[model samples]
Target: MSSASAQPANEPDNVFRDPAFRHFWFARLCTTIGYQILTVAVGWQMYALTNDAFMLGMVGLVQFLPSIVLLLMSGHVADRFDRRIIVRTCQMVEALIAVAMAVASFSGWITSEYIFLFVALLGGTRAFETPTLQALLPSVVTPRQLPRAVALASSATQAAIIIGPALGGFAYVAGPGVVYTISAVLFSIAALMVFTLKLRQAPQRLTAPVSVKTLFAGFAYIRSNPVLLGAISLDLFAVLLGGATALLPIYAKDILHTGPWGLGLLRSSPAIGALVTALWLARNPLNRRVGRVMFGAVAIFGVATMVFGISTWLPLSMAALVVLGASDMISVVVRSTLVQLDTPDDMRGRVGAVNSVFIGASNQLGEFESGVTAALLGPVGAVLLGGFGTLCVVAAWMKLFPMLTNRDQLHDHSAHGSGKAATAR
Candidate 1:
């Protein structure tokens, strides 16, 4: 996966020209859609079963628990085994789980406990699949196409994020069993595609015995590099503080003088913005001052959050959300490119796993933070404070992580390894 791997003369410049990439991309789309649909269907089923808000919350808890519990071990497994097989296995298992859920739903035997058990199982498989897939991407395409691939991947995810829930909700009308059956089919398709992927060369699987040091090696590697640490942590803090989406319901209903329709628009605005940005970047890759650009994007994210927080007008609020989404996409592309290009082939899984955890923590914890702060300070006050905190984090991070601020190119990461923290080792 080195940058020096020459693209074959017969190879086309476009990422889609590679059959492997096309298969990989389509597979990702299917799995994301299936999982998102599962999420919506499961939430609906859980609430209907228990009629309890706590059980509804438990659905999310069951999913998050697996990532925290298995992340280190899963990272170790990803690095040691063939990533394609790992991903394929996870997909297959998820498909089986979907089948079971479908059967139960149709049989009138699906209980809240049954749903929770399977959901946790699905979450566990994803913990393994996610990091492995991140590691697998560089091998599917050349280093030259990695950034474009990352952008395309982002687009697939964003599109699925929007499509999955909507489709699930629509299909649920036909019956919960119909939604579950569709999910099973989609997961099976993804599993088949993942198994078919051929890496440029066979990976040299790690045969070393497992140990505490080996399990946590990803953290050690990240800590060894300031740029890597900065890029990864910057995202964590920025999103943690600037997350205003959790408060969108309040704004849409109370402040903006609108209804569920307004809330839907508010929610979709940022995702729509992100999807467009991802498509744009896929065609026009970031080639210069990526670090500065990432920071700048984050700064704009903070600003947009603040603007959205205080704005009373619906259009103004939606506008701010769109800008916020666009800026977040830029940072995502930068961080993804940096991680893939900067790390070694063998270590990609471990690094990717740690990266996944940071992302998960930022998202899960950020929502909690928003809820608590919103309760204490009120919705507008919470959002405004979060945005201001994001700006402060940017300033502090710029001064603290000089390596990230001064970083120049995504492809030339290896060339700029003058600092002790330059390479993950």
Candidate 2:
């Protein structure tokens, strides 16, 4: 029998069988859960305390500033240092921040300013951790297994995102302190799992001394690669304009007339759709029409966002969010796979840093934008405008980056040659 035929239908391939990757997957699940819980808890508490739309947006800004400020240093650190250690150290810092949040909430000292301060610290931890974690993935799995690995990893995270928010919302009924304490415990568990992993990494060989030029190598590399730039930029601008998550708390309370549990359900709805799609992708990975699929998925995301923006009923809003999450997952997997496949191993760390920065801008800066827009236009108007803006971005990107739109098949590196070649010119 052929090797493919010999593999049992019920069993996962060797990628799932790998012990190290399994542990890493579990660690990611735990970490995602912790972070999601923290997000729900903080967002709810911040809105409750200040009742100001802009202040809620400032919450995102505070978390975002640290990552951008340390972007270069973060990439360099991941490249030069032991990545496992870097990830673990960052997790420890996050755990401490969670602890501080718990104490603050319990004492009734958790003002918006204090929440912003703690979240800022958590963002600093994320700045160092994200690139290292991204770079570390290749060490755990073989190149051939990477697509499945990415899918499984994404599924794990989506599962956590689905569960964490609902649990946090219920815990919020008891108090923010309870939700924070759970986050602290989960963070510590994730750290311990990372510590236990025996990663297969090549010895670090720094060929060049650290300098201004060396630090900015990621930017230069990305600039020279139009495919990479186009892919990242598409996601950055589309989501930046389309995101309505920061205003969710307001929607749940004022627009939808839902309580804390309803808020949790709202948060989890997207992840539920994402998790379902992720699991299916893990079993049957995408190989053909990769670029077209990404573009189509993003367009769906924009349409769904508009639907959710206008929705007054809970079920309609939740359904829209579900579609929104499902569409975004396709873009996430494609962009991540492309970035990982194209970059040289030595430069992956720095490239991962650049990727993280783009993500932060889309998510964090996007939240700030939502807040400002909500203040000016009201929540419904802000989200509607964002969704329309996202569609325009997609059209513009299609015209500007024809390479991305015309591209076929994701697994083939040769298809990306035009983008890379365009960069060198």
Candidate 3:
């Protein structure tokens, strides 16, 4: 089917204004906030147990390594099943994991090893859930509303990132156990909300038997498509080099001379900035010069990272982080819209899974990079050098993928035969 043909005529005129979308959006927001709480709680607890930066990296490693291993299989599963059910199942698993952690923490049985195990389980569930969620978005609204939906999703996530850490920090001061318990409760609520959503399923294709060859097709697609490869690489390099979140505890305790509350603010500053920009973009979508905007935003992100690295004042550092967040959000929306528009529906699951791996790698690998660099060069030097490194990557990518740089408008040309790409200039 042609991209235009994919638009369901029965779709409500006010799809973007649909109540179901709002419920879905709120569920995602709640889950993200809970995830943030768990992240901070685990990191703080791990540091208190073992002061090694490498161990901090280990936390991220455990979460992402399994994701890398299982992503292709996860994609296959999503393609063959109901996405909503997949999402609900994964959320339920996540809720159980949260409950386990809460029990461990509250009962004084929580340990670094237990946390690692919990993170690993969470990663496995995410391997299945992430692709399903991404693939489900187009089903929730018409193609014309996708840009708005994407913006709303991004803003909601950033909002969670903004509030989660602050709430986690406060909860931590009261007790780590309390934070874990609260996260569990929130996760349960999110799962319940997801259960209440009424999404129409897309028609499935009858395909040839699945095999290892089919499994690797997603990787082959990514390797062969310049645009997809370029976008993923851009994200990986920028985030891997510029990610400073992993080292926030060090700065909070040793550098900034701040309490848990201040640490929360510092951690959340970027997301707050991102949320502001995302909300604006939601109101006024970026319909032109997307390529230039993406590149410029990423460059600005690098610059902000550099500034944040050197700033001793809390307010200046927070301001720098805000800029970084805003810049990152711009890149996020541009790349995501491009990817979704370019991908074929039959291949959405596998392609989205591959994208998830890139995201996982960028975040977890970035955490590892930050921890190791901080250990080797001290926090200031590590962050400053990382910012410079990100700039270098962006410059190189811009040179290598000139097509991405010069692209004047989004197109839906398929690079594969699975089906027609579902958007156009």
lDDT of each: 0.88, 0.84, 0.80
The sequence of per-residue lDDT tens digits that candidate 1 reaches over residues 178-201 is 999999999999998887877765
Q: For residues 1-425, could you state the per-residue lDDT of candidate 2 as single tens digits?
A: 58546645544467778888888898888888999999999999999998986787687778889989999999888888888888888888899999999999899877888898899999999998888888888788765567778888899889887788778878899999999999999989989989998765563433578888778888987877766788999999988999887789999999999998788778878888898888888878887788788888999999999999999999999999999999999889888877877766566678899999998778877887898999999999999999999889888888888877877766565744543453333
lDDT of the structure predicted as candidate 3: 0.80
Model 3 clash number: 0
RMSD of each: 2.6, 3.9, 4.1
Question: Which one wins by lDDT: 1 or 3?
Answer: 1
C-alpha lDDT of residue 78 in model 1: 90
Provide the clash count, candidate 1: 0
Model 2 CA deviation exceeding 4 Å by range:
1-12, 43-56, 100-116, 172-178, 200-206, 247-263, 371-381, 413-425
Q: Could you give candidate 3's per-residue lDDT for residues 1-425 as a string of tens digits?
A: 58657776534334457877877788788888988998989899999988886798788778888878898788877776777788888888888898898888878888889999999999898898887788777677655676767788888888898788879988999778888888888878878877887764463531746888667666776666677778888998999999887778788878888888778788878888899998887778777777778888999999999998888888988899889999999899888877776666556678789998988788877977998999999999999988999889889998998877776565444343333432110
As for TM-score, the candidate ahead, 2 or 3, is 3
Error of 3 at 133 (Å): 1.0
| Global lDDT of model 1 | 0.88
Give per-model TM-scores: 0.95, 0.85, 0.87
lDDT, model 2, position 52 = 89
